[model samples]
Target: MDEQTAGALPVFVFPGSIDVIFTQPHTHKQLVTLYNPYEFPISYRVLCTAPKKYSVIEPRGTLKAKCCVDIVIRHLGANIRSNIGVPDRFRFEVCKYGYTEVSGRKDIAVRLVENASDIARQASLDQSNFHASFPPDGSSRLSPPQYAFPSNPGAPSSQSSPWLAVVAALACIGALMLPTQGDMMPSLLPTYLHLSVPQKLVAAYVLGIVTMLIIRPT
Candidate 1:
């Protein structure tokens, strides 16, 4: 599969990167969503560049028409100080339900951040890369224009730089990954993971501003 080339895959992936916090207990996991926007079912597999460093759940599966699958990827390596700042990546390959050949490919970076502020700064930067593009049928779990990717990235005459569908997706991923009111699921997430309604609202509002900054004209 690594030697194959693929055409446009109708699947959508979120966050653009999978970020795991480096800490003790090492229980935090990142969620990567694979969405099938087409009417037909699709088969997909996830591949990692650094296989020994992480573990993925549902690495291969079939997504029914207009459905999405959430992949749970956890950092499995020890917290090695020497590995900080290095990058890891995951590749997604998709094909029609019955086929073994690849139809399309998507890749996402993986980062292990040492602290909370690094995560915040990364999220802020991620939010400024939006351009809103919806699929043909217009049914989207995320109402924010399929995460707002610009239509063109190669047109020299265009004013706005076309980026991958992200920022908004990453912001939403952050919100989704935040722990809810439950002790059953233990995590390495910071103690301040809890948020009130107003606090959540402010977070959303701030993220909205970040999205505007990227989509807006310079």
Candidate 2:
């Protein structure tokens, strides 16, 4: 591991650099924020190089632009760890000024660097209202609606249904009546009142009880 770390530093390579190779398994982290101002649209990306010789083996998803977004590098594959090296690279690009295919390739790197500056500045300053609701006088308030909290909550609570409860109760009663092959006279409960798992079982018991009660013995 020591020898591998020593060789990866100072020299830079592309298409899976040393950091890309030796990254830890099942580890990742990321941060994102909105770049859309009232008029201009914005976007960004950040690439972090481990300060020490470590590889970022595999990343699950593409880093995207938006507020409160984060990325995590899940360390995978063989040997990997965070050691002394360059601070992870923060790469960002903005189309707020203007974007062209030619300009995109030519100025992409510069945009990324500037993007970091813009993000840092925004972070340091106090956050203002990104959204609001209008009042009767055409004035606005910064607070969100009260019901929004319940509409999409983090965890769910239990709910009850009366019809489902009835069905479950009947099912339990039927199971308890199983042992006697539905013998009506042997039990105090009437055969007609019993629920059988097999409909035929209950029907036969009811008919036999009725016939015996109605008929005369020889």
Candidate 3:
């Protein structure tokens, strides 16, 4: 166990930044996740630099050991007039249970993203993430008409993912080849190139899954 002095300022791990987006006539919201990696239990409480600009749910709570918690931060009065040009943040204070001393502290920066293209990109990303949680057959796989929340940042990049699937497709073909067992066998090929029955089956299984994913309607 590490004893903490008042000067020691270790902090919990979380996304380094947050963005609150304002696109149209609606209340804007963003979510922040707090992570606790310690073995012992801890308590957390949040303070805002601009409290009137945002709403935080369950602003303080006990966090279990080695766990994660989601903090919903809604932009209060999220129209263009109120949130514009104002820099806001959430201040987090974490301390070990039963102790008054703060074990960790961090300040999270919040930005309001109002650009048109940026909002579209963010809405698309959020939809894709929601779809990913379900099976491939889920209707959410394609972007559906829906209200967008605070945008999540990931969008699948085509440059890397397709090449991986291509390799898997090739492996499926290679899996069909059998090891040279008789006089017809040649010595030129390396022994490692040979596919045993189990190896072949695994490759075939992988190919089947990828094939289905590729063929699925977008």
Q: How many clashes (backbone N, Cα, C below 3 Å) per candidate?
A: 3, 37, 0
Alpha-carbon RMSD, candidate 2 = 24.3
Best by lDDT: 1
Residue-level lDDT of model 1, residues 61-171, one tens digit each, is: 899999999987766553665545456656677899999777887666666667755766755554443222212222232222112212221222222233432456467
Query: Scored by CA lDDT, what does every candidate get?
Result: 0.60, 0.27, 0.59
- Kindly indicate the candidate among 2 and 3 with the higher lDDT: 3
For residues 5-28, write the lDDT of model 2, one tens digit per residue. 111111111211112222422222
Q: Output the lDDT of residue 123, model 2.
A: 28
State residue 132's C-alpha deviation in candidate 3, in Å. 40
lDDT of 2 at 206: 58
lDDT (10s digit) by residue, model 3, range 67-129: 989887777545655555345555666788888776676656555657545644554444434
Off by over 4 Å in 2: 1-28, 43-79, 101-218
TM-scores for the candidates: 0.50, 0.21, 0.47
Report clash pairs, candidate 3.
Answer: none
When summed lDDT is taken over every stretch of 10 residues in candidate 1, the lowest stretch is 141-150
